[model samples]
Target chain A: MPQTIQQKFVHQVIGHSATNNRLASKNKIGSGSAPVNIALSKYWGKRDATLNLPTNGSLSISLPGLGTKTQIERLESQNQQTDLVSLNGQRLDQDNAFAKRVSQFLNYFRETPQTFFKVDTENSVPTAAGLASSASGYAALVLALNDLFAWNLDNKSLSLLARLGSGSASRSLFNGFALWHQGQQADGLDSYAEAIDTTWPEFCVGLLEIDVKQKPVSSTQGMQNTVETCALYQAWPQQANQDMQTILQAIKDHDFATLGKTAEHNALTMHATMIATWPPIVYWQPESVEAMHKIWRLREQGVAVYFTMDAGPNLKLLFLETEKPAILQAFKQIKILEPFKS
Target chain B: MPQTIQQKFVHQVIGHSATNNRLASKNKIGSGSAPVNIALSKYWGKRDATLNLPTNGSLSISLPGLGTKTQIERLESQNQQTDLVSLNGQRLDQDNAFAKRVSQFLNYFRETPQTFFKVDTENSVPTAAGLASSASGYAALVLALNDLFAWNLDNKSLSLLARLGSGSASRSLFNGFALWHQGQQADGLDSYAEAIDTTWPEFCVGLLEIDVKQKPVSSTQGMQNTVETCALYQAWPQQANQDMQTILQAIKDHDFATLGKTAEHNALTMHATMIATWPPIVYWQPESVEAMHKIWRLREQGVAVYFTMDAGPNLKLLFLETEKPAILQAFKQIKILEPFKS
Candidate 1:
């Protein structure tokens, strides 16, 4: 017979006051928020797998208005062996890596082997659209767990813990420019996040999602292949380090030209590294290349817009909020995006 | 009823009495020695059609003991329309571009009209290899003409004339380390060759002729495509300027590391620019990429070797003569080179 740990905790807390009462009556509730982060400098490879340490450092900006709202509650139930997790009221299996990592972390402090925990998450941001849905999702989970357990850990500590789950998840803990320092330590204990500048609330990043349907190779596998097979991967570390310093300085000086140039070069170099790998891989679809060219042509024609891409086919155009309509109009002219425009 | 204005000069040059005796004897004598030049940086684009000015700068080194030897003898002929041009005693039509250009230049001086030139030529270099046979061929022709006419013009002046025929031909005039500066001026008159550190005789370049049957695309068309469409070409001017400065300094300092790095980067950047052009052309064959990787791997394994490619699939490995056998062995392992072992 499996002794129910939740029943034991409840019995110890309320002295078996209501045996007939549902286990949901004795649950703990918490709410948390997470922000969407845009990577200023992209990270493409991993240096260490066990700790999820990046080969190159990256910078990101955490947006204020867009994020995930998550709520979690631990319930006492008659069902003991079953682990139930729900996202926005939809049931989720416990086998998920993200959920497993979270559950493992929780089990470390609880000192009780609970078979399962239910997590309810609501993502306000678009799911899987390259707007960093995972960033917000993971961030909200970390924050919600922190609130439920009354853990007074700082955001940086939470970020370090979150990094073990997803590399980009750490950036969402802060609402500003975040730099993930890839420390050269064996244990990766020193690797953590630091802020470059507070988020520019007025600055808006316009995303032109081209509605790509195919799933991309996960970042973990893609990066591993590049690191192992890319002839140019060894040279990338020095260049990326130099670029990081220059881009940080540019951001500090508000030098948009330098920032955009660095971003574009870094993106191109990343793609070059991919091509240099054995059995060369390219993230580019025809539309992706065309979109880049269009953006470059528009910029050359005096449009004040610059574009950046993460590990997806969608392009993110950085511009002033006032320039949004014009940028949208230009994107609409592209046939691929025409289907998506209202 | 057209008068032959060149009767006096042609009689004086060939000696009419000797011409009549030669017709009876059927004997021919050829004059002048012209060296073949190989482009080190590789010329692959044209800037001006009329002048045959290159879009980007090219560098070349003269091949010792190889090239075409030709002799031209002026003959007085009564035929006004017939300009007899013979190569090794066979007559060639004067309507071709080669003949037309040469005749046009000669006519610009108004030195002689209605004169038939008997030409005899022999080529010692390997024909149709990526070894710049055309460079040697055209260079020889220009030098032979200059020598025959007693033009009193130096090799630089001769190269300017040669540029009107082919771009790579212009780089062949100098003995070592020549640069073809693509002058920004419209007339391209200022565009000429300059020698960099003519004293570096210790440095030697070896050609590993990976023979292929087909001819590569002409450099003139490649450059036009690159200029019209390559986004990376915009960065080339700045990069090339920096590389030129570094390479010059390295040659002066006798720093092999600097020389090798600059050369490798310049070659790789050139190829990168080529691929970035619209419709994506690649000078690299499977063997070429394999050869590059082999050299790179060898270098990583502590071999002192570097490589550069011209406008074909064949590779040139620049290394000390003593290390040539071992490097060739390494290339053989990759199946890039055939067994050359004795």
Candidate 2:
């Protein structure tokens, strides 16, 4: 009473059809929005520059509406032509630096594989003033391309590609709390971002802009200088790792004070490493200093708010919705700083 | 048969004569000038707060002619009624904080154990502004009193006494390159400052004043806050030790580059620890930030100047005599910063 060959053939057909159904769904053009993520536990150094493997793990959160939207479509032309790219409705010149980086990123797919594509992206975030516009921009590109090319890569695999474009971009794939693990492998096969939670109690990030200009030294280059010359540079990875764990625990335990406190400490430590570098790259403006004191004043008043900054003049204030009114009122007194929601 | 009693008595007579001659030299009322010493490798934390024993060693240089002139005279009466204290020729109240401190210091003198004395001091340095006026101020008082009271206290023992009043004052006991060792003792008998060199090639220090007001939190209290809560606090002692060694070697080797680089790094690391403290005691003002950038800019222009700030708003710039014209010309551009020789 053994099963017949026709029955086995019928079972294989069922499995093949289900697989085809999933792939076919991704056959058409696709678009997605990837929000910009702010690192509460920052990622600074790299273990492998070529593979984009971080030297330490980091934790970040996505500002739900502050991000980029990218639309991508596979071109039918098979002449091995370049991927046509347009940013903010402008056709980027092939010789433009950003366009070249975008094309190079597209080439990373299968290493000279035969599919040309078109990419269009627009951002709702700041460009280079350290709000991490590139993070959200590249994250949107990877997501849209993953959908259009039918590569069927999972979110983690897509994150690996996103990191090649920008390091912080890897964490932008997730919605709420995302952690990019600092993998030890040379190939960075295990280094990727994962979503911790899709939602949390609605939290608002107030951006106190000090300057909106591009820096002379980019964050990547600035970090390279820090790694080479800072005497305290050797201590960053271990401290950041410990900070990541403490922050992660704070998140799990639902302790906002511990979370905010650790976030501020971690951010300051990151800047401390920079300031210790020979010729010490200082990014803080005079107004930024005043703004920080104001935040401290707010905390002194028992306002349950904290602030962090990246490699730029803008200070990001993280607090719950309940504390917004007091924070807003306090910052309003400062003539220089404009507190805003993104 | 080794020696006759007369021979032994002769040896005793010579010793007594030498001691008498040393004390006899201070037959009249005594007055002296002790220049203020600025720490290059700063002393920030204390192991024994009551004794003013630093948690780490420090190195400093004394500014000649920029200090206090203290005059001390023993009273003729047996009243022990009051030790008159005057600053800048104005008699201070008996209940004044400084007068109380001076009386307490006089209590340490064993030579005039029951003697009430009068003390007068005048400061040419910025008091309580981190230019270390107290360092030179207290140092002058101790040196003058040590002479007038005929205590026969060596400079080493006197340094310990100065530390009881102010920590950095210990270094002011020496002329230049004074080092205060952080000793591991409960009573702090072993902690004292020693001279590395009595004199060196004349070097100038440019004082960039940020504010002349007293700080809200004193250095002692600020450091306590750092030790209690800063996550980066533990790494400070080890980093400071290495920096001290490197800087000490640089001083011996006469390598300005190594000295300047390590000094700047060491100072920033200390601030890093403070910045990580809960509620983070930040001592830097906005102009301080600008002054730091200007130093980096000056170095980029091939100048060999370095900066170190203690727990105050003034920044001390150390450079050779050759760089004076160039530094003065550069600082003239900033109106808020008044750079001057100490």
Candidate topping DockQ: 2
CA shift of A134, model 2, Å: 2.2
Clashes of 1: 1
lDDT against the true structure, each candidate? 0.61, 0.73
Q: Supply candidate 1's per-residue lDDT for B191.
A: 71
Number of the top-ranking candidate, with lDDT as the measure: 2
TM-score per candidate, chains pooled? 0.52, 0.82
lDDT of 2 by residue, A206-318 (tens): 77767543245687888888888766667779878888999888878777889898898888878877776666677876667777877887887899988888887778888
Model 2 Cα lDDT, one tens digit per residue, B1-342: 114332232223224543355345564676767888877787877787767888888888777667899998877788667889999889999999889978866665423356677888998765533566778887888778667745567777778777877888888987767888887877577788898853446466677778543245677789998888766667677777777778777777777778777887778778767766767677777677768777878887899988887776567787777887888888763212111233
- Candidate 1, residues B99-160: lDDT per residue as tens digits? 56445544422233554565556666655445665565566666666555555456666666
